[model samples]
Target: MSPKKATEAPLTRYRQTFSGKGSFGEYLDVSRRFGKDKEWGVRINTELLNGNTAINSNDMEAQGIFANIDHRDKKSNTNLLVGYRHLNIEGGARWFSLKAAAIGKEITKVPSAPEASKNYGFDGLAKESEGYIIALNHEQKMNADWKWFLNAGMNSNKLQRNIIGASSNFVIINDKGDVSNNLMSTQTVTKNYYAQLGINGNIKTGAVNHDVTLALDKAWHSIEGAKNMYNNGSMGSVSGNIYSGLQGNNVWYPSIETGLSSKDQYWGISLADTVKYKKAQLLLGVHKHNASVDSYNKITGRVTQTVGSDALCPTYGFVYQPDEHTSLYASHSENFDKGTIVASKYANAGEVLNPAKTKQNEIGFKYANAGFLTSLGIFNIKQANNIDVYKGSDMYLQQDGEQEYQGIELSVNGKLADKWNFMGGLMYLDATQNKTQNGTNDGKTVNGAAKWNAVAVLEYNPDEKFSIVGRAMYTGKADIYNEQLQTPSYMTYDLGVNYKTAFNKTPVTLTAMCYNLTDKNYWTAYGNNLILSSPRTLMLSATFDI
Candidate 1:
C-alpha cells in the first residue's frame, strides 16, 4: 500500500487576448493540484459588437466570468463543488430603419421627425443589466450501487433601460395620400431575484440504472414604468378602431406608479431509468411540473390575480450499437417554454396563459473508423400555444396555434493525415407555421430558421511548436418574418496561427486569430425593422505556462 511513484507534476497556464475592435477580448487559465488533489480555475470572456449589423450609431458590449472549484477525498463518500458566474450586457439598436418598399409612409422604423433647432430626442434607448449567481452542491455515495446529490443556488438581476426618442410611428397612407403618425415615449426598469433548491439520486441494479430528481424554485420581480406622453396630444384616453380609415387617440401622462410586485413558485419532479444489456440500451423518463404566479394589480388595488398550471412531460429513447464502429439511436421528448410569469400577473384577468409546449423526435446514426467519423440525424419539433404580439395591441398574448420544424444534420470529424485534421457539420431545416387562428398564418414559414447551414474547419500541426487553422461557415437563405420575407444567404471564413516554444525554460505560446477573413456581410437576427451582423476582425494572444 505504499504510495506510487510520482508520474506527473503540477502545471499552470495563463492566456490573454486583445482584438482589433477593443470590444472582443478573452482570457484563459489552466491549473492542476500539487498535493491535496484539489483543482480550481476560472475564465473571463468579453465580446463587443461581435456580429451586430446595426447602424454606426448603435453599439453593444457583453462581459462574462465563470469559475469552478472541485475537491475530492478517496476515504469519504462525500464531495463538494462550487460555481459562480456573472454576465453583463449593454447597448444595441435604438432607432429602427425603414425598408425600401415602405419609404414614403411612416412605417416600423420612422420616428418623430426632428425640428430645425429643437432637440429631437431621437437617441436610441440604452439598456443595462447586472446579474450575480452562486451555486453550492454536494454528492454522497449511499451504497455501492446508490449515489445522491443536492444543489442549491441563488441569483439576482437588475435591469434598466433609458428610452429616449418618441414611440414607434405607425402611419398608413391610403390611395388618396392621407398621412397620420402615432408618437409616444416611456422608461422602464425591472428587478428580479431567484432561488432554487434541488436534490437528485441514482441507483444501479444489474443492467438498469434509475435516476430521480426533485426541485423547487421561487422568483420575485418588480417592474416600474411611466408613460410620459401619448400620441397627438391625447391624454388619459385609449385608442380604439385606429385602423381602416378610422382615427382614434389616446393620452397617457407620467405619474408616480407603484404597483404590487409579482412572485412565482415552481416545483418539479422527474424520474428516469436506463436499461443497458448487450449492445442495446433503452431510456425512459417522465417529469411533472407545477407553477403559480401571484400579484396585486394597482388598478384593482387588491391582491386578486393568480395564474397556475401543471404539466407532465415524457421522454423515451433507445440506442443500438451493432458493432464497435457503428451505432444508431432514436429519441422522443417534450420541451416547454415557460411563459413570462410577471407579465401575466399585471395583464387583464382572463388574459393570462400557460407556457407553450413543444414535442420533439429525433433519429440518428453514427459511424467511426480509424481515420473518419460521421453522424447524421433527422429531427422534427411541433410547438403549440405560441406567444405572439397581436397586430394592434400593445400587450402580448398567446395564440392557440401550432408550428412544425423538421431538419437534417450531418457532421464529420477526424484526421485526414498525420499532420492534418478536419471537422465539419451541415444542417438543413424546413420550418413552417402549420396551423394558426383566423387562418392568417396557415401557410406561413417560421422566421430565423435557415434552410441550410454549414461549418468546416481544418487544422495543420506539423510539430508541437507551430500550427495553423482555417475555418469557414455558410448560412443559407432564411425567412425574415413569419410571412416568408427572405433574407439572402451568406458565407464567411477565418484563419489562425499559433507558435509554442520554451523561453528561459518556461513554456510560452503565441496565437493570432483572424475571423470573418473574407469580411462578408451576414445577418444573424432581424426583426422589428432592424438588421444586425458583424464584420471581419483580428485578434492576437500570448500565453505562459509553468
Candidate 2:
C-alpha cells in the first residue's frame, strides 16, 4: 500500500472583534499535517467584557486553549484532544430575577433602575472562577464491513461564589417599592468521568442490508459543596433593602454552615440494528441502564442515604422514501436519567433521589431538490421527575408530577438564486404540567415555555467579495408564572455586511452588524424569571487567513 496524499497543509486563521457594548473577543486556529498520515492543530478563544452601565459596574474575562493530534492509517484513526479554560468575574453581572407583579405596563422593559436590581455586596465580595477539561477519542476499522471505536474523557470543575443572593424567600418588593432578598453563599467542586466502547458493522442477508451496533458505557460523577442561607425563615430577612444593598460579607465565614457531598455512578449497554430493503428502513434498539448514588449528611458528618435504580428502555424508527427527493420517518424512544442532588435551600438538602424517566415520539419528512432543502416534524415528549415546590408549601424539591410537551417544527434552507440564500424556521408548542399535589398546577401551561417562535435569515452576495445579510427573530407570548402572568410577543431584526479582500496576498474578511435594528425592547423568560433584552448594539470584526 502507498501512503495517502496529504490533505491538510500548514495554515492559520485569526479573528478579532469588538462591540459597542464594551465587549471584545479574539479567536485563532492553526493546523498542519505531519507526513501523509498525521495532523496537528491548536485553537484559542477568549472574551472580555466591562459591564459598566448606569445600573452597576462589573468586569468579566474568559479564555480557553485547545490542542489536538490526529493519526490515521488504512484501517484505523485516532484523535486526542486536551483543553484548558479560565473565567474571572468581578462586579454585578449576574442575572436578576423579577417578580411577575413588577412586570409593569411596558411588558418589554424591566422596572426602573434601583427597583429592578440592587447591589448585593458585589463590590466587596471576592469573585473568582475557573475550569478545565480533557478528552480522548479513537476509532478502528476491522474490515470492509465492520468497525469499532472508543471514547473517554474527564471533566473537573471547582467553583467558589462570593456573597451570593438566593431567591429562596423570593426577592421581595413592597407596595412602597422597597426591594430586598435573602442572602447566601456557596462553594462547589464537581468531577465527571465517562468511557464508552462500541462496535458497528454492516451485513447483507437475502435482499436486505442490516447495520448493527452494540456498545457499553460507564459514567461517574461526584460533587462536594457548601451553601449557607442568611435568612430568618422569612421573606426579605436580610439586613439591607435594594437601596442600601448588602456589602462586606465573606463567602467562607464561619457563620456559613450547610453543605452537600455526594457521589453517583452509572452503567449502560445498548444494542441497535437498522434493516433496509428497497426504499424502506427500519430500526430497533434497546438500552439497559443502572445507577447508584450516595449522599452525605452535613450535620451527621456521615453517609446518610444510598439509592439505586435500573431500567430497560427501547427505541424504534421507520423511514420510507417514495421518490428521489422526498422521505418520511417516524421514531419513538425512551430514556432514563439519574436524579439531581437536592440544593441547600431544599428540606431534603444533600439527598439524592430516584431516577427520572422520559419518553418521546416524533414524525417527520424531508424534501430536497433544486438546491433547496425543506423539513417538517412533529414531536411529543413526556417526562417524569420535574423538580418543583409543590403547593407552595413543600420545602423539599419534590417530583410530585409530570409534564407533557407537543410541538411542530418546520425549516427550510438553501439557495434562492445564483447569489442569494435563505434560511428560516418556525415552531409551535403546547406544554402542560399535570399530576400535581392537590392539582394546584394541573392543566396549567408550563412556565417559561413559549407557544410560538420563528426566525428567518436572508443573505445576498452581488459579487465574490461583498455580501449583505438580514435576520428577523420572533417569540410569542409565554406564561411567566403558570398563567398568572404572560409576556407579550415580540420581534427583533438584525442587519450585517461583509467585505472580503486581499492584503499582501493574504485573504481577509471584515464584517459589521447592527442588532435590534429598530431598537426594540423585549423580555426573555427563564423558568418564571424575566430578563430584559439587550438594546440596539453594533459589532465589528475582521478575519485574516495568515
Per-prediction TM-score, please? 0.74, 0.86
What global local distance difference test value does model 2 have?
0.71
Q: Which ten residues in a row have the lowest lDDT in candidate 2?
A: 231-240
lDDT of each: 0.56, 0.71
Measured over all alpha carbons after superposition, the RMSD of each candidate to the real structure, in angstroms, is 8.2, 4.9
Tell me the tens digit of each residue's lDDT in model 2 across 400-492: 578899999999999999999999999999989988779988988887889999999999999999999999999998885567667678899
Candidate 1 per-residue C-alpha lDDT over 1-546 given as tens digits, one digit per residue, 9 for 90 to 100: 111111235445566666644544444444344344542323232222332222232344555554444444552322222233333333332232223344344333222222111111223334455565555555666565455565555555544333222334222222232334344433344555555455556666787666655555555555543333223344322221111122324423333333444555666767677767779888888878877766555445455567777789899999999999999999999965555443321223223355677899999999999989999999999986354342343324455577788999999999999999999999998877766778777766765567799999999999988999999999886654354345567788999999998879988899898887866654453332324344466777878786
Off by over 4 Å in 2: 1-7, 39-56, 92-94, 98-122, 125-127, 168-178, 227-260, 298-301, 345-347, 385-387, 390-396
